[model samples]
Target: MSRRTFSVVVLDSLLSLATKLQSGPMPEPRVRTAGATRGRLWRILMVAGVLAALGGAALVVTVLIRTPEGSAGRPETAAGLPGPPIPPAGTDAVEPSAVPTTRPVPTLTLPSSVATSASSRPPTTSPSAGRGSSTPESAVVPLTARYTTSSVTAGLLGYHLDVTITNPAPRAHTDWRLVVTLPRSTLSVSGVSGATATQDGAAWTFTPDDTTSRVAPRASVTVSFNVNGATLLNAAPTDCQIDNTPCTT
Candidate 1:
């Protein structure tokens, strides 16, 4: 061989040696590198998915916990969301079943002395209010009688005198009579009101008529008579008596 060709062949051998040293080993295939890259991408995606799933679970738990705080014992909606909170029942809004109802009771008030005052009413009066002649006689009731000349008028004979008899007793007299003494020659009997008159000599007895049978406690009765003689003009009645008792003139 020539020297230059030997040198060129040696130099080419050195370049090949250097190239082999720089390359070291053979590079992997594109299919293997692509497969490895796909495996790394798959692993990263799985980790991200797991983290997202954990975050979703945490959010769900938070929602459940918060939901119970806002609306305790409330049912969930169709969308898995919590419903609105329910307010406590107020006093005015309480149901009839929750509270018992009672009827109002009536109260009665009476005076303190009602029993005593009722027992102290006035006593009832007796059934027989007045004393009658037929009544079983009791003690004589205190009484007084008076005679008065009510009126005097001149007449053909002489004068006529109207006399009134009054009873001052506090009780009634059912039967009454009056006796009067006068000059028979001067006075003559005439029509009498509310009584009957019977004369015998100078004494005259007057008995009560139907209307004057009962003399009220504080009442008066009248009797009238005429005088035939003129001697009665200045003369006065002699004496008057009632119930056998002397009477005042």
Candidate 2:
């Protein structure tokens, strides 16, 4: 108990006490402050969780409102439903098939005389008519003319005729003549050339041209003449001659 020593001893005791206090349990004020801070943090976390849940609910409601009610019956979008099949190349789209129909045909017949004559005769020539009269020129040699008449016109008396000259010889003929006699009063000549004409009573004579008178063998030339007669005269001649030779008479 000296004064300085006593004071020093008391100071040491105070220091030990402060150290003990620091190492001991927390003070009431600090613990309360910490509790208050923890409470505030917990409240903030709960509020954030609630807000997130509300936002999720709002999104679900929007989706439900946007979806169409009728879409349920149609094919599903996300289920990967298949589309209509495509048609094969060059083929038409599938459709119902159709039925078919059918039909028939016809025929013809000919006369017996024509059939028999046609069959018996040679294809190119006429049959001999009688005995021994040296086969007529047509039977001796086959002669043909392309046409018997040259020029034709439609008229009141129908049509007129001309003479056709045919050269049945193998060589070309330089001279040709045709003499046609008809009743002069019954007919009138509208045009004539390179011909000599004369009349004897009702009959007239026509002498053919000698200048341009040339025809090739197996070929023919036509000379026209005017005629006045029946309307049926417009028909073409069935018999024709080659040179002086008659193919058919």
Candidate 3:
């Protein structure tokens, strides 16, 4: 029977036995009824004690039968559910996860004596203003040219100039030109080498020949030209330019 039914049956039997004990006894002379009444009451108490013991035993048996074999001594939670197991004796407790720490910014050091401030850069010359292409200023290569005197003939005072054209970009540049202005007092002009030569009055323009047509990436090409009437003492070339870039001595 269910727990409630079993408890109810035990209670009903006790009540029934008590009812019979009271029903069997009736009124008599005071002294006589007193002894009988005492005996009847003793029997009722004895029967109640026996029934109570039997009921307790039945309840214990029912609990043992229903419970799992090894779970009798296990502790239950407040809600009657099993809790997480406790670590065994001598076992280490689990450590909590570590929290990440923020790193500090790097320190920058500079010369203490020098003050720092933002200043604008002097504007770079554009190609178009210097007889160069109409290409956008950003697309123009930052070319630079320089010349040195390679040789000088005694009588004619002929000057062989080694003009170096530097291609600053990382790609080939073609159809390059070099322009040089000689002194107006020059006696006679000689031919140019390394490039095709042309003249407009005092200005001598040299276009690239087939062999010197392209300037390789990040390289310098030397173009030599012979000029007469330039004295050894004073053989200065003025306004020398390659692709509109001014030539430095």
The prediction achieving the highest lDDT against the true structure is 3
Each model's C-alpha lDDT?
0.64, 0.53, 0.71
Top TM-score prediction, candidate number: 3
User: Candidate 1: where is the Cα deviation over 4 Å?
Assistant: 1-138, 150-156, 232-234
Clashing pairs in 2: 166-243
Cα RMSD to native, each candidate? Answer: 21.7, 26.8, 20.5
Off by over 4 Å in 2: 1-158, 183-185, 193-196, 201-204, 228-249
What digit string (tens of lDDT, one per residue) describes model 2 on residues 152-192? 54555545565555666555666443434333345545455
Of 1 and 3, the candidate ahead on TM-score is 3
**TM-score for candidate 2, residues paired by index:** 0.29
In model 3, pairs of residues that clash are: none
Error of 1 at 192 (Å): 1.1
Full ranking by TM-score: 3, 1, 2
Per-residue alpha-carbon lDDT of candidate 1 for residues 153-235, written as tens digits (9 for 90 to 100):
43335555565666665567777778888755447667567788888787888888888787776787776665455543554
lDDT tens digits, residue span 49-113, model 3? 76776677667656755764476655566677777878899999897888869788898876544
